[model samples]
Target: MGITDDAKDALSATGEKISRAVDDAREKVSDKVDEAQADAKVKHAEAERDATKAKNDYKEELRDHN
Candidate 1:
């Protein structure tokens, strides 16, 4: 015995749906990663700015003491 044309069609349709779902999930994950990367960059810049400000304040204090 052999499989019928209807069964093959149904299998093909299922495969297409699964592929689409996988692609959608992949896009969602990529978007989240991009957002996280942007957030990290902002945080790193803020930290650098804070550190520089603190260093300048310390240097000013040393000058005042001298």
Candidate 2:
């Protein structure tokens, strides 16, 4: 009976450790996804700014020619 109890305790501890590890991994992945999304947003904003600048520059050139 003592041996059986010991085995059960060990199994429970191992399960808890595995659960914690899985949770940690899930959190890390979520953080990375959020970081990637933020980076994409920044890139999109930069592209928009560049396009607006180009358009304005072209307009200025037309005015100068006239």
Candidate 3:
């Protein structure tokens, strides 16, 4: 089945948040992307965790709204 409007919005917002985090991580690491690859990886992993939480929260919200 297709996702609900609310679910889509939630997912999009979560993605945007992750993208921003990735950008911030890149900026913080600075100058040499290769040297800072490890930090970038960690930041992406944390963002993934955050995205998972966001999805769960959205699922609960959908349940409540329904």
In candidate 2 the C-alpha lDDT for residue 22 amounts to 100
Query: TM-score for every candidate vs. truth?
Result: 0.75, 0.89, 0.43
Model 1 clash pairs?
none
The residue pairs found clashing in candidate 2 are: none
By TM-score, how accurate is candidate 2?
A: 0.89
- 4-65, model 1: which lDDT tens digit per residue? 88899889999999999999999999999999999999999999999999999999999999
Instruction: Tell me model 2's lDDT, rounded to 2 decimals.
Output: 1.00
What do the candidate models score in CA lDDT, each in turn? Answer: 0.97, 1.00, 0.90
Off by over 4 Å in 1: 1-3
Find the number of clashing residue pairs for candidate 2: 0
| Model 1 Cα shift for residue 21 (angstroms) | 0.4
- Best candidate, TM-score-wise? 2
Evaluate candidate 3 by giving its C-alpha RMSD to the native, one decimal. Answer: 28.3
**Candidate 2 — worst ten consecutive residues by lDDT sum?**
1-10
Better of 2 and 3 by lDDT: 2
Task: List the candidates ranked by TM-score, beginning with the highest.
Answer: 2, 1, 3
Quickly count the clashes in candidate 3: 0
